[model samples]
Target: MKNYWSRWMFVPALIFLFSSCGPSAHIEKDKSVDFSRYKTFAWVDKDGEGRKDRNNRNDITESNIRTAVNKQLQKAGFEETKRRPDILLSYDLLVERSTVQNNDPVYSQPFTRAFYSPYYRRYFFVNYPSQFIGYDRSERSIKEGTVTISMIDARSGKTVWQGWATDEVSSRNLTSKEIDAVVRSIFKKADLAKR
Candidate 1:
């Protein structure tokens, strides 16, 4: 009985450990498409006109994303080519404003007070019990960023695979390391081992 209870308790703990890792990536792909035929890739937005972040940091963030994605794809035997490639790749980054609400419990402090009683004709001390009061509510604004990557067939112009990740961001642009992690998470969820 002891062993069975211990084993049962461990299952929930294991599930919680994995669930709290971090934000998860979402992926979509065409099941009927043959992924193995895709060997070379090129950027769909070659001129950067469709990018969201076209400010001073636009070039830096674009470089970070491209470097990370290229590294991952090359490791999987996919090459980047400027000629007529098998697939066209495109990525986008978007940051949006959000609000978070927090509520904390409010409590009353216990205390003792002295009072005069007419029946007892003496001073008496009474203790007051602590109790729940109410809740303190607050709201704060935050910025969240989402990165999306898409792979389309060059000849047919149909998207074959797509992945995206969303998380709280510190700035409008992501650093190189942050971009790498985002790209890595997206590719990790992709089932392109055979290709």
Candidate 2:
């Protein structure tokens, strides 16, 4: 009983912690474009020249991002073709320094006190009121990463679908897990239908 109660008590805190760590994803696409027609995709640059313009480019990070994106696209029933794909895929990643403000609530820890229960003829544990002291305000600099993926119409040379994801990163380069998360988040918002 005690373990069950304690487990349930931390549910809200666990939820908040996880919810705050997820990346923010957004997508934009041509409303008139038919996503179902895009059956094959080829990278705009098979080499790494596409990312040469980015100052924070890391070869390993780029590879991880591409692999993750490839997995998601293939899962969506899109094939990778080099000859001439229906859509051209391109991706860009940027990690910039940013400041985050923290305003955490301060509260006194609750204590349990024994109280006499005349009706029950026994003693029971009563929780004392925990007062909110105030909020601790602080600021810290952190690295934020934004990954954008664009799918363009090969013949028209116009972007048909684009999605981006932003999240707090530990450093200038993203870990494998983080790259996967970013790609998964962006693809989750993509309007790809399985063929």
Candidate 3:
């Protein structure tokens, strides 16, 4: 009974351990652009005219994202400006839901026991077991969220760099610190300094 309980406990621990490792970021950039030439950036919607159309995000959420991005960019030596900036910065948030079905094989067998005959001194099997077969299915719904940041050349008006991070969404909303961590992971893969 103890061994069965231990095995049952171990399965969930393994799933939790793997799931908590977090998600990876994906980044892409235009190789032809000269990143060193750009030192300043301005928000794509500097005038706030396109905010309603492009980003339907709430004010608080948008503010948090912008603050996080600003900190990360400033750390990378890029300054924010209102006029004649070298590059334009913009971001988008997305949430998607999907169903995941897991078909696990459930096995069952009849209990067996060996009994010894005193006269013959031989053991005989009772209640022989049967072949194993799958009998159960499980299904779950999962939500995934993603944040994408883009950098465009002010003069050419073309996207020069893009980075995105995706992770499984939880029931509770993400904290500011968690959002910052996700942005940091995306930029780590971007490696803008190398450009």
Candidate 4:
């Protein structure tokens, strides 16, 4: 009986200690968002440029991007405003694009990869994660991008909901599949009560 109790206590104690060793994060919503107040949807381009130029409405021709976001909201049970949407819709596009060299050594050969192995191979024996770190020898580059999002109240003309996503833009510009995946993930993260 004593041994059983000790074993049980040992397991839970290790679990508590291991769990507590990590970070502490919590966010409780007093209540969910009420979509009732919003009705109309109109795209906004506060700083209209290539990101979202009202003058060149044709420049931002990815209606599917908007559609994908709308679908996510609808799936979450928010009704879209048909006529005069309660919410004034606007696309606030803030695209941060950069060429990021993926130092991920997966592309490098076994010995050639950026093996950030301790320079003192004899005494300092430590396995570092430099295999993928571009280090000095091998390098890979890709376009990394971030899109900041925003929402405005149609009536009051005030900003309401806002969110953004950072993603990899391939050589093919912004593929529909890429946009859809990233946008959907953004909505899910900004909303889901993670299970």
* Model 4 stretches astray by more than 4 angstroms: 1-36, 44-61, 93-97, 101-139, 192-195
Ten residues in a row with the worst lDDT in model 3? Answer: 46-55
- The residue-level lDDT of candidate 2 at 71 comes to 95
lDDT sort, best first: 2, 1, 3, 4
Summarize candidate 3's per-residue lDDT along 129-171 as a digit string, tens digits: 6766965788899877788999999999999999999877763
Clashing pairs in 2: none
Scored by lDDT, model 2 comes in at: 0.86
Per-residue lDDT of model 2, residues 11-54, tens digit only: 99989998666797999989998788888888876563555565
> TM-score rank, highest first?
2, 3, 1, 4
- Candidate 4, residues 97-133, lDDT tens digits: the string is 4554444334343432243446655443344343453
- For residue 94, give model 3's deviation from the true position in Å: 1.7
Q: Candidate 4, after superposition: displacement of residue 97 in Å? A: 4.7
lDDT for model 3 comes to: 0.82
**Model 1 lDDT on a 0 to 1 scale:** 0.84
| lDDT values for all models | 0.84, 0.86, 0.82, 0.54
* Better model by lDDT: candidate 1 vs candidate 4: 1
TM-score of 1: 0.68
Query: In model 2, where is the ten-residue run with the lowest total lDDT?
Result: 46-55
